[model samples]
Target: MHVQGVDGAEESNDGSFVDLRRSQAGAFTRTQAMRCGISDKVLGRGVRARQLQRIHPGVYVDFTGPLPWETRVWCALLACGPGTALTGPTALRKYGVDGDWRDDRIHLAVPHTRRLDRKSSVVVSRHRDLPAILHRTRRPLTVRIEVALLLTAGAHRDVSRRAAVLLDACRQRRTTPHRILAELPALPSLAGRSTLRRILADASDGVQSFLEHAYLRRVERAHGLPHARRQVRATTEQGVVYRDTEYEPYGVIVELDGQAGHADSISRWRDMTRDNAAATSGKVTLRFGYQLVSDPCSAAIQVAAALQHRGWPGRPRRCSPACRL
Candidate 1:
């Protein structure tokens, strides 16, 4: 038997070993090694010689030093054994939905019948319909984006965080509200199901983030303000851009900024350009960040003022007894 060592050139007279390590980011499970015909003695010798590094009990990577995030994910999956796939925030990250939705520990989903002892660095979730949700063809094995979003949202206790997971997934174009809604029925017991449904309804109308949802529910609906067209597309000198909320008839646009603020100078510049273009077109642009949005009543009042200034004769009603609107 011929075994090609991690070095790619060195060969050993052992059981035949296929080079499956490369596809898994140079990581493979002990069982995988054995399946490839690498004996326990050869594996132990590779580890002893520092050609293989143990990440988890049964997972080994070919190289030494720090492991990349992708490599770590592969190791985690291998450690959990077969029939397991990435889920929740870990899967969200893999799907390229950026933001605060990330977990330090690897999140995985397995069949309900599968039981494994918990590891500190891994979060295991059991699903009765795991097979239905798994993206079997995807490398690194992950749940579908819709499943990942729903699972991630269900794991969060905070309504805002939960909404953010679903919204961000759509905002980043990883999945759509319709896709999520279609998958919702599969997990009837999901936490915050009603809230998720409501959010998805609004999302269908272009609500893309928790802040936008807040502005819709608290500022617009609660205060009896005019329904603004959301995620309105407009062509500008800075190319095509989408407005968060546009009261087209009233010539007022409301921009909801996240707490994290502009990512860089280019983003800030683009925002300024967009606002300037709106002003040049005789439209009033009102920008609100986390602080202002947190006080929805106050935000409503400001938007109402802008709308009224732009010929919207409707008066904003107070949302509650304490509302200053």
Candidate 2:
């Protein structure tokens, strides 16, 4: 007999008792099973028959085959009880946000006032003022994308890595930096507020990568250089090429070459071809790498000089004491 709950969970026709398994990735809790008309006797019967496998104290997988990573996550959430939602990398992954997901454990956020059983594969975090809509929306039992990113940011101490995670989340999900900034005040304190605020400001200024962002913060903004247009696309014989940063009025193109993309011969050749094309078009190209982005003062001075030669009429300011611009 098919049954339904007020929460909209339904049962399958095969008399599995708990239909939550279908929606919950083949995992369900004892409370949900009982709510779907499964008695303790029947539950024990299913366990004995191998139709159900206990994963947590009160959670079971409806199937016997090897469980996938997502199923394990689902099992963790179900075991954590209500008012809990996936957070951090787990929730971010659901939103198609890129990050490290091989941690082999699930992260769930519950109300700070509530307590849950400790499980080795599950990390239960307590949050004050857990946003209600994160779990109430169509993407039930999981935090929102921005919330997940914010939470993930709070866990990371390295500023560059944190910026990469947040920026990549924005890039992959096509979420606006303004939306993230607007929500920053309401989020629980995890990341350093001042640092996050700085990164977001740089992001709003059109910095896209860790390197590009560093150049903006440490070189351009810090040294008072002209704000260059970012990720500018230009058409060439090789189709289209994207300049990392560009001063269109001065015809100065700055390319940030990360090792991963510029390491191969093919990539190097393409970069050279694009640089030559820019030169032919009367544009001056300047390329920077991780090292330049790391210690950007010298590179900033060179770019400043190039811009001056192209009639920029502005001098880059010194960023710190004992530093030359």
Q: Give the best candidate by TM-score.
A: 1
User: Tens-digit lDDT track for model 2 on 1-325?
Assistant: 2222212334455444444566678887888776666667766777777777889898888778788988998888778887788888888777666666665678888898987767977888887788652746744478767767777787788888878877776656557677777768767465587787778777787777788888777877888888789878889988988888998999998888777667789999999998999999999999888887557888888889989999998778888897776
Encode model 1's per-residue lDDT on 148-189: one tens digit a residue. 888888888988888888888898887789999999888877
Question: How many collisions per candidate?
Answer: 0, 2
How displaced is residue 85 in candidate 2, in Å? 1.1
What does candidate 1 score on TM? Answer: 0.88
Model 2 regions lying over 4 Å from their true place? 1-19, 35-52, 64-66, 131-136, 237-240, 263-270, 321-325
Q: Compute each candidate's TM-score over C-alphas.
A: 0.88, 0.83
lDDT of all predictions, in order shown?
0.82, 0.77
Global CA lDDT computed for model 2 = 0.77
Candidate 2, RMSD to the unseen true structure? 4.6
Query: Which pairs clash in model 2?
Result: 154-190, 154-191
